[model samples]
Target: MKNLIVASALSLALMGGPVHAQTSAPAPAAAGAKASSDPIVVMRNEQRAARNAFNEAARPIRAERAATVQAAVDKAVAEAKASGKDPVVAGRVARRQATEATKPDFDAKMKPIIEARNEAMAAAKARRDAAMAQR
Candidate 1:
């Protein structure tokens, strides 16, 4: 679950071509980093970067969802108290409504990122498999 969230951003990040097109002069390795010429490792780094971007993009959507849920809960709780109904049940219903309301926006916003992430992951897997077969 955690990994899915981490490795889930796509498109421009992966399309930067560092994974597929290795430069002649590699950049200096960062502190404590082990730089390599390995294609699989390069691809893995690209995937990680894409996922990071995805997570960053998701932060706003998640924030909006939280706000929406809070608003819904507040309204429902008030209504429940006025009608002498169970606040607990009303809260649950409000949460579900909030999720449903935000779901479409989430899906629309995330579809491209998700597709890109999947493509990059698949390409990496294929490259790794081919390398293993050669070995």
Candidate 2:
């Protein structure tokens, strides 16, 4: 009688087993639908805009620097002539001096841009490091 009860319990448990249904649905597409706008086209347009802005911003600086250097050269030539030195030698010396004089100004103008670029690169490196660590 105990054995019969055990068999009955086992049969009942077997009949009450959990059931799972197999899915016939296809897998979802790997990526979202293609962007309405092409990425390459957008990137190229952005690049063009950046170039235009850079050129516009640089124009005044270039013109000002040219004027300053020219003035320095002219002054040097005049002084050299007054001192009875060769005009060519004076012009060469003036160019060297003007280049030296402009160094500080040029560096000053570029410092912020350089620092920003360095900061951006550092941030990118940090992000990359974090991503690699996750992997």
Candidate 3:
């Protein structure tokens, strides 16, 4: 649950870039530190950067890959229907085929950005854990 929250927060933080740039008011500081100097603040910034980079890198490839996946799924469904499979079964098969066909390319293209984000999240988690331990 906590991990899910972290991932969601990271995604949201990254999707639109930095919050400070988007808002007129200054960002609130982290406890005991200036906002800019806070570790979590730094992590969030890093995540935003990674997200921006990923978006730029993935934009063209993503569209092409999505089209490929949709085409594959459509073909799969048509073939299954031609074989007299039930509609529900055909749809499921199509979905599975689409995922299988796209997974490798998607991972190849997105792995670096994902790794950076994961590393940032892990570091933040470690800091949070250590802080709790000291308390």
Candidate 4:
């Protein structure tokens, strides 16, 4: 299911690209300067690669944590239903409680990865913007 969702998302992203991008190779940079050699381009690519690596590393941890939280939510909802409370309100309360219960653990696991990714993205964005401004 995760694989299907990820594949669908990737395919949708690809489909959203410029329509003419499929027609031919992109034009080379001027003066024979390779586009890939540009520092800003390199930084952008590195940022994406780092983000992907973080996502890959975080996936299993996230899945396990989500399942644990979901179990708590299910248990809460079941208990509430057994007491004759409104299921919708019960679900909302369960969700909030589950989220709060799981948040500290989730944040502990994800904080470093999130911080590194954010730094990489910020650096890449700054470099890319500077490069664009020179054009």
Candidate 5:
């Protein structure tokens, strides 16, 4: 009976050996990598990458929006003068008209950009959350 009990215990220990071994051993470090094993550092890196991508995506949209608004303002001023208005008054009117004309279009164009930025921010937050959960 003792022999049988010892054998059963040995078998159980052997069956659980891999599990214990896995938990006991530290994961091998990567070659030449100095990244802190901290979850926060990993999360920050991910967020930084997302921010970089968002900035890259936003740059062209910003440039185009600026050019379009400028062109619209210029057109408004030219049109005002062509109508025989005083240049100062025309310019004021043009500025208002240009602003009004561009407002909706600008909002429309910016909606997607804003949404994209929000998505990036959300993704960054999600990554951070996940990383925090790891701790």
Candidate 6:
């Protein structure tokens, strides 16, 4: 799901072109510079590759943490329902409690990965914007 979101955002970014891109197709580069050799483009590709690797490494940890939190919520909801309380309210309470209870452990496991991904993406965006502005 995180992969899907990252892919979606990049696809949208590429398909939409730069925010200030002209409607008319751009002319060939006057400097004979290939996009493959463009530093900004290369950096973007490298950042994306790093993000993919981070996602791969973090996937199992995320899945395990999710399963643990979900199990807690399920048990709480089941117990509440068995006692005849409203499942909706019970689920809401259970979700909050379970998430809070599990947050510290989850953060310990995933926070750095999340922050690094965000930071890398943000730096890439800044680089891309600066490159576009230089156009």
Number of clashing pairs per prediction, in order = 0, 0, 0, 0, 0, 0
lDDT, candidate 6, equals 0.79
- What TM-score would you give candidate 2 relative to the actual structure? 0.52
Q: Give me candidate 3's TM-score against the actual structure.
A: 0.45
Residue 116 local lDDT, model 3: 71
What C-alpha lDDT does candidate 5 achieve relative to the native structure? 0.72
Residue pairs in steric clash, candidate 4?
none
Model 5 lDDT, residue 78, Cα: 85
My TM-score estimates for the predictions, one after another, are: 0.62, 0.52, 0.45, 0.60, 0.50, 0.57
Q: Rank the candidates by lDDT, best first.
A: 4, 6, 1, 3, 5, 2
Best by TM-score: 1
Better of 2 and 6 by TM-score: 6
After the best TM-score superposition of candidate 1, give how far the Cα of residue 56 lies from its true spot, in angstroms. 0.8
Worst 10-residue lDDT window for candidate 6 reads 26-35
Best by lDDT: 4
RMSD of each: 17.5, 24.8, 15.2, 12.6, 21.0, 14.5
Q: Residue-wise lDDT of candidate 2 within 1-135, one digit each (tens)?
A: 999999999988776663312244443531232221344444444444545655666667767777888898999889989999997798888888898888789777756655655555555456555655676
Each model's lDDT: 0.78, 0.66, 0.72, 0.80, 0.72, 0.79
Clashing pairs in 6: none
- Model 6 residue 78 CA deviation (Å) reads 1.3
* Candidate 3 ranges beyond 4 A from true positions: 1-39, 79-85, 116-135
How far off is residue 23 in model 6, in Å? 22
TM-score of 1: 0.62
**What digit string (tens of lDDT, one per residue) describes model 6 on residues 22-80?**
65657565334434766576666868776997889799987887787788778878988
Residue 129 error, candidate 6, Å = 12
How well is each residue in 35-100 modelled by candidate 1, as lDDT tens digits? 654667766776777788778877887787789889999999999999999999999999998889
Candidate 3, 4-102: lDDT as tens digits:
999999999897676656685654553334346555666566566656766777788788877887787777778877898776677777778887878
